[model samples]
Target: MTLRLSVISASVLLALTTHSIAFADDSAFEVIEVTGHHEGSYSSVSTDSSTPQVDISGLLEQLPGAAVNGNGPLTGIAQYRGLYGDRVNTQVNGVTLASAGPNAMDTPLSYASLVNSERLEMTRGIAPVSAGTDTIGGSVKVIESQASFDEISGKVAAQYQDNGQRSHLGAKTNIANQDHALLVYGDLLKGSENTTSGSGNEIAPTTYDKNIFGGQYRFNLGDSGNESIAIGYQHLETTEAGTPALPMDIDFIRSDRVKLEGIHALSSWELNWHLAYSDAKHGMDNFSQRMKMPSMNARYNNADSASFDGAISVGKDTWLFGIDSQLSQHNSVISDPTMAMFNVDNFNDVQDDTYSAFAQWQQDINQWNWQLGARVKHYMTDAGEVSHSMAEMMPAIKMLMTQFNNADRTQSQTGVDLVLNGRYQVNSELSWIFGLARKQASASYQQRYLWVPMQSTGGLADGRTYVGQMDLELETAYQLELGADFSSDKLTISPRVFLHRIDDYIQGVPATDPAVKMAAMMMGDDNPMQFANVDAELFGMDLAAAYQLNDSWSLDMNASYVSGERRDIEDNLYRISPPKVILGVNYKSNNWLARVEGLGVSAQDKVSKTQFEQRTAGYGLMNISVAYDADSWMLKAGVNNLFDTEYEDHLAGYNRVMGGDLSPGERMPGTGMNAWLSGEYRF
Candidate 1:
């Protein structure tokens, strides 16, 4: 019974007192229709591209039940519909952190750096307990665009890509008036070593490097901004990155983050607050960035982490109240730079904390427009008391670290979340929506403290090897959704259908402990795995559309379909993602713009023999882009796989780096035929 919370989220204080824009050519896909009392329908996607995304999961795969579980090419694990890693919840720029690589390869969308990210929002279905303290596999927001309440602006960009000869540059600056404002940004990206798979080979020399910089300070107490405060700072540095599907590689990762937000305007209630902090340090190795191992199998790992989250809110005239929090701590070790007596503690003194409280209500009732939210969350995890030196000559790893150090590694949990949403605006171009939810999660301190056998499952790169699960439970979800929207004046569409049903669903099994299969066959792996509690069920449908066949032509589309199963072992559910579609066509006026895209996917034979999975076949691709928007200069170009098709991306990951050209658990191919160029400037 311990809870520590800091809450805020009144839509991030109405998006920090509003007025934010910094999207230079966000490539349209616009579809908005609201009436008689509203607010809800999303998509802010546009990770500003000219193709040169070494990360940000390729712009979260163009949203719509999104997907990306690549694990190298600079990692990326974020799945919306079929839940992914720590059950997805990330907010960068608004801060919420933890991912110092426990095999996540620095996931959490790799701290939103796709060359100075600007927007990558989410919230289309079943998310809302005021958006997070864990949305139970939902909640993503990475926004950065502030400055200009009246004055100096900034932007500078650069890009180049020719399949792994990649590069990107970034800059941002803004200093304002009207009671203070400032924003500073920096970026850099590097590459080489992905020679465009799909038989153009070279899938494992694995190279990548990254950088990001940040700054923010905002203040206003009257004179609009409705009373506000903001302070922020962020920095990230990654070096020698390469995750050939895990087993080490990534010589470094560093992070530092901070945030504080505010809003106040009393006169009948209005207050908001937000706080965030993070520190991450990570290092990995398996022969100094890939290949060459002897000297007792050379390996190294170092980890350090910290996270503090916040929220505080109050609103009136539509009711809202909040309290939310997060706290994280981790430390990992494991070394052997040629044996300093080969140490390993891997994860010691770890902790995962959470706290929350929420209440929300919105109303309109004329054409209906309602929302209801409620939440109560708690989780406190613990660890510490572990040791190893190859477990004193391995007595089955010293009896599983003496039975996980005499057991009782705490885990306390409490959860209750609910949401009821509605829209029904049968006029002004149609609308109908519904959502009901109940979500929760607990278990992820790398799934209850790994005491031995490792692949550090958090990234589940699926090379397999796992351990940890000390009375783990609590992973609920029960949801429903239905949707609609149809506008006119040149068409518009939005659709949805959903289901969730989770219940305990933790997954990963096949370690019928016999001292964890004799210490995973003396640490060489004999197929050990564990992390149970299952039940599962997932259903989906998604769609988004646009038409407007005139006024410089337009057309857009997106599609998704999900299906996960394991309602008590009928199998199927483990890296699920298949069924996809995207289509585009555009033409803009004045200052030319052009686009043409097509993508299709489908052919994943419902695999997952308990993660012995492998099934992919089905692909299509095409792309083309053109832009020129000059006034202060802008130029863009693109040509991704225009006809160099060669598929195999069942969500990648499984090429355990050993040699070039992949093998040793194959399947990690997709990407070839590229062309990109970009330039931007604005002042």
Candidate 2:
């Protein structure tokens, strides 16, 4: 299968290359100047007619050094360089959305619906401190449609795909006068349990249905100010969604959110304020999506969060400052209807609060642009009384719980961040960029408060159980980056190299205590681990290039490579992405456009034995798309994974679902050939 796909891809590439026009000296894309003095590897996504209604992680994959690790259709976790999850900060309209599920079934990007957004941007390498607090990975920002007063506008779109029998419909409208405006949007998506692997075998428990709706109201303040209030709600229902890396299957996830924002302009400064609140409820079970075990167990978890932010900014070469705060609470419970006395409280009254203050200074000196920023943050967590039915059955466990309950259950920590960025233009067509930063992040609530072994370690899905360390110290990172951008009439290229060293990096390792291992064995548990701190280092390089072959054709390419290892021991880090490359050709005419691309990933042999990581083989995929535009309507059609070659992703989690050809510990298979069509009408 792999050989067949590679031959097909090579033939397509040869055909496209032979038909290309003569090379010409011209820019491949229009260059847009940034409004601020920020310096970094930044890219903006086009939200025009050609963009599809997919998750944020899917869109981010178009950029260099980015990948999406999927647990479900909507649960796409963004990975950049060699880090992911909480290490990266995602913001929608300058507000952060907290995950609702303990296993991260509802990721931060899950809240930002692509149907209602207008623009998206990503910052690569070391991000500025002003972007957000605790940003060791990078940042993703999304801007939603805003109320317009110039005229009334609306759009309706629909799409269908054959892989999972998936369907989507969305509509949005804006109504406004000279003094006030209102915008409303809604979307519906549904799919069946028919997702097929590259081998044409159906993957069970992969169906879902979801609905989203939101509205925003804006009122004109004076000449250059406005106040807006917005509300959003999302409901997701899953019949048998599988989490191959974790222990359970998701049954349902429901979330609701509200936000209020106001901007006021003064003589030489602008004041901005925002407030947000969100609530999420999730349920999971072992029998719903896979083979039923003797213990027909079910679990439910609920989480809620509230946040506030305020900032004041002056003109360029001035100062900007702000303060932000967030508070969250979590609770969980388990039940078994067949057994009368089978009940457990996994988590109870777990609360966390975070507050931070930041300031930034940007200035332009001669031919150089520079920015300096700092942030201070305080974090605290407390867990009320916790109990479980298993503890009661085991006297040794009961004694450990008694001691834990009597000890102090509250912890606090404070950390600081500093960042500096500079850019220098050597000539009109070349620029040099450099950045340095020191960042810190406190442990999560699950890492600091979990009393029993569980599978809630940031959704690693590694099929390992871990216990929390209450006295864990904060993790700190030192990072540096250097890059250059070269642009000419017919070519544009940007390349960057970065290095990161972390102190007291937190990770899960094998639990070696005799008594703990004996107790776990007695409870029918294996692969017991505990969270510990170790030093680590990572280095990587990313390159992106584009060339214009003529007025009707263009070529683009991107490549990324990264490596990570434990500094204190001779072992490799876990779940790091292997080297990858993407190449594409695009042809455009008066009213239509067509594109073809090939993507390839190299084999990953650097496995981490302590984490029980496995190696994966290499694979390549072929894709093609075409689109056409009329007076007020547009249509797009595409096919992905054209060869249906069977392969597994190095970053994918293990297969845990029963009643399948694949074993429990085997890597999950990638999706097979899929064809889709979409259309939109605007007024």
Candidate 3:
């Protein structure tokens, strides 16, 4: 059986040699969200948090129309509101991960591991249709460090930061009674090289190294146990990381994951299921972690991907039904290793699959509270048959590789989605909500198997160089949302507004294939681009608030704004993320706590002249923190940009490596002034 499943996946990744921190009992949670509409958790990192930063969507971007494009230091990428990347939808426990380079640099929440997470949330606004199947830039979830039922327990943590002397360590262990449980974890992070609070230098390769291990097993089945099961395994390791807006960096990324879940209590519809599998092997170079290029512009790459996912659902009371699927495969290769006849074949045997079925309904009547959904999807794609240097180059890449290896690359499609939501409870502190949807997506095999013109496009880090388009179709969207939520007793609030009207909105135009713009102007790109399907529109608004001026002070705020455009011309919508705001002030006692925060932004000249995208200026920063606790132990301290401010974070990208202090297209500077501390203990 494949060597006993590879020796139980290498003994659960060498017994969770990465991260873990679940002391598991300090619990008390109560959420009644509507913040942006269905869920919008946005806070939770507990492990005696102190932030040596480990990008889990940049720590959920402190939530409010979240954002984070950042192309390095673990490859962030997760944007909402005005969409982003593969239009967001990142999950972990419920699987749906897929991303092995292709420019993403192994993103997919970089295989989440934030202080031994146990449910990282975000679902804000219209993610219905059972929350799967291409969630138009929305939905984020993660779960780890679970399996409890009595518990043997454990915990450990560490963190340190001094502008890029960063270091972190984590630990976790567990065992349970009441029907079995087991868990494990590990983490280690390292960094060096990072300076720039308006230019203090450093920046050669914003260094990093990472690792995260995992384990899980849960049990109980039948004999009136009503059934239950859980099994998981994980391993992620990244090395020599540094992605100066990517052109190559990170000489390694190895990922392996497996999952299985179940629940049954038949007799009355109540069975759920899950299955997952993943594998990734990535390698990149441009001279291993920055600098050195020329020796025929040395470069190297090797990307691989494999994914499988399954889902099942069944509900009892208010009706629910489901079926979900996602399967993927990819391959990439490139070379120049001192020109061994210079290779290529960027992608081959690519495949993409998705299958879905959904039905949902919820109710509450009386002051209203409905929900309805419907979904149907099926998409399949294929590719294979490609060559390069095994055949050599030039001649407009031999007329686009002989017209894409003689066409007919197979395809299939069928999509449909619908949703409607509502809420109203007008009184006892008000409430109201609304949502509508229609979504569809397809075409990603690097937008249909890239036939040349590089920059791979999956990460769309905007260093533009695209090429891929073969009768593309299926890209629909039509959404709307409106919101309100208010609560008294220490005040609370939420506000939202949204709109979208898209149609075949894939973007990146202007190539007009003259042999793909003469092979992208012979590789110097004088304006090249492809992957059509246009017409777009987006609108936005956001707000989240809190206050509790008594009982040891409190106050909070979050704001957002979005705008996209291109109703077939007149541009805008390449990186969307302009207005933003955040504020905080807190204090507590009887164990100590403190906070001070602020962040502001607003300057994005709505660029994107067909992916020329660039324009950002506007900044603000301030942060502070403190914590205590004790009982089992805890401590934390923080200082982030507490006046080291030097700005530039318009979704940090650009500056494709080149001996650095940033100059190659600038943008990509933010982070300086750092001071962190963390500690934890429990047993």
Candidate 4:
């Protein structure tokens, strides 16, 4: 039955492409121009009348050197270049978002709902300190849709995809009469059976449901000033969602979020204030979503966070300053309901706080534009007290716990970051870009306070248990970037390359201490590791180009390559993305559009022996899409992985879920060929 469906979808895609080619004409089609400060750094603005109401990670994948690491439909993590997780700073409507999971099951970007957003932007290279604190990798921002008008206007949309059996519906409306305006929006999304892999096998336990609603009001004070206040709320629930990379399966996850924002404009100065809060409760077990073990193990975690930020700006050659603060608390417990005696407190009353102040200056002189920024941040963490159920039965484990509790449980650090960027327009069709930055990032809570050996090291999913380092030093990075942009009437191209030198890079190294090694072996574990500092270097390049083929057709291509190695050790960095290229052709008419694309990924042979990283073979995929417009309505259809070729991504994590055909250490398979149809009506 699946084969028949795949064949039918392939035939339909081919027929649509043939029809589109025959209908091509000399009529000129509009092309969106890409804007950027350098070759590796660019910005994209959405022009669609209504947002897709999908996960933000999927949208980010359209950019060069960007990919998504999938654990489940709602647990996608964004990867850029060779870095991910907290290394990348993500924000929504200029406000920072915090992750609510110890293993990062809910990434920062996962909270951003597309229904209320206008555009998404990313800075690929070393981001300026003003972008955010601790942005050693890059920065991503989601701009919310604002309400403005002398009249009333609104839009509503709905969509469905068969691959995940997902459905989304949303609506937004604004009412204004010169002096005052109000905007309101809402979204509903649900999905099931999201585990059908490319090999016709179910991955088990991938389903989710979510709802979000918000509103904003604006008041005009004068020609040069205005004030606005906004409020938003979101709730999400998931059932039997599997994280094959992690040790446990998610039986349920409940999350709630609330946000409040205020903005005031006065002459040449603007003032912005934001406040947000989130609470998440998650549960996992060894039996519900996977095979039952001899001794049932169940875990529960609760996390809550609050953030506040305020900024002020003035002048076209803007000078801006801001202060941001965040506080997070987490607690985790493990138990076997079947056997009440097996219960422990894995993490108890863990608290983390971050406070930062930043300043930025932007000015243009002649043909040169320059930006300089600086930031100072402070971090503090406290793990009140912790204990385990087995500590009483094991002398070595009990001794370790006593030492951990007696040590300094409270730790703090301070760091600074600086950035300088310049762009010189040599002529009308060409520009030169250069950037230099010195950035610093403190270790994550899990890296510094995991009192015991566990698989919670930023979700590496390498099947190795790791212990935290309480005295680990902060990581400092120095980066240099150079690139250029060129454009003509019928062609446009941008290319950039960058080099990064890192000091005190934190990574897991094999444990050498006799006591620690003995304890790990006694606990039925092998190859135990501990976090330590090391030196590393990374360099990469990104290229993007587009060419118009006559008036009705266009060709677009992009390629990315990156390499990373430990300078102080004889091994490569773990889980670096392989070289990749994407090529696409498009045909457009007054009311119809068609596109076909091919993506290629090179084999990854630069594996990290120390981390036991696996090498993956290269793979390619074909995809086709078509869209049509009729007055107030629009239709879009697409077929991805058209050939149903089974392949595994190099960055994919291991399959830890039990009762699967694949082993625990094998890589997860990619999705199979799937077709989807969607329609939207503007009213």
Candidate with best TM-score: 2
Q: Candidate 1's residue-wise lDDT over 157-212, tens digit each?
A: 88888887878788887888888888788888888656576458877756787988
Q: After superposition, how far is residue 548 of candidate 2 from its true place, in Å?
A: 1.6
> lDDT of all the models against the reference?
0.76, 0.71, 0.75, 0.70
**How should the candidates be ordered by TM-score, best one leading?**
2, 4, 1, 3
Count the clashes in each prediction: 5, 2, 9, 0
Residue ranges of candidate 2 with Cα displaced over 4 Å:
1-40, 47-54, 224-240, 295-317, 513-515
lDDT digits (tens) for residues 312-350 of candidate 3:
998888888989899889898898887798788889878
Candidate 4 lDDT, tens digit per residue, 1-683? 23323333442243223222111122111122357542235544352422233576666655666666666566767777777777778887676655656677766776666667766677856687767777897887777777674658776767777767878887888898777778888877776665467788766555666666767676665664366666666666656666767777666666767677767765667777777777777776666666765653555444434434444333233677778777777776777766677765566777778888888887778998888889899988888677877888877667777878999988899999999888898999998888999899888878887777777666677878787878889899999988877776766676778898999988889987665666687756678888899998988776666766666787766667778889998899988877776666787778887778777777777878888988887788998877887787788777788998788877767777666666667887776777766676665
Candidate 4 Cα deviation (angstroms), residue 480: 0.8
- Name every residue pair that clashes in candidate 1: 6-311, 7-311, 7-312, 8-311, 8-312
Poorest stretch of ten by lDDT in candidate 3 = 20-29
Alpha-carbon error at 137 in model 2, in Å?
A: 1.3
> Model 2, 489: alpha-carbon shift in Å?
2.5
lDDT of 2: 0.71
Model 3, position 370: C-alpha lDDT score? 86
lDDT rank order:
1, 3, 2, 4
TM-score (all chains, Cα) for each model: 0.34, 0.91, 0.34, 0.90
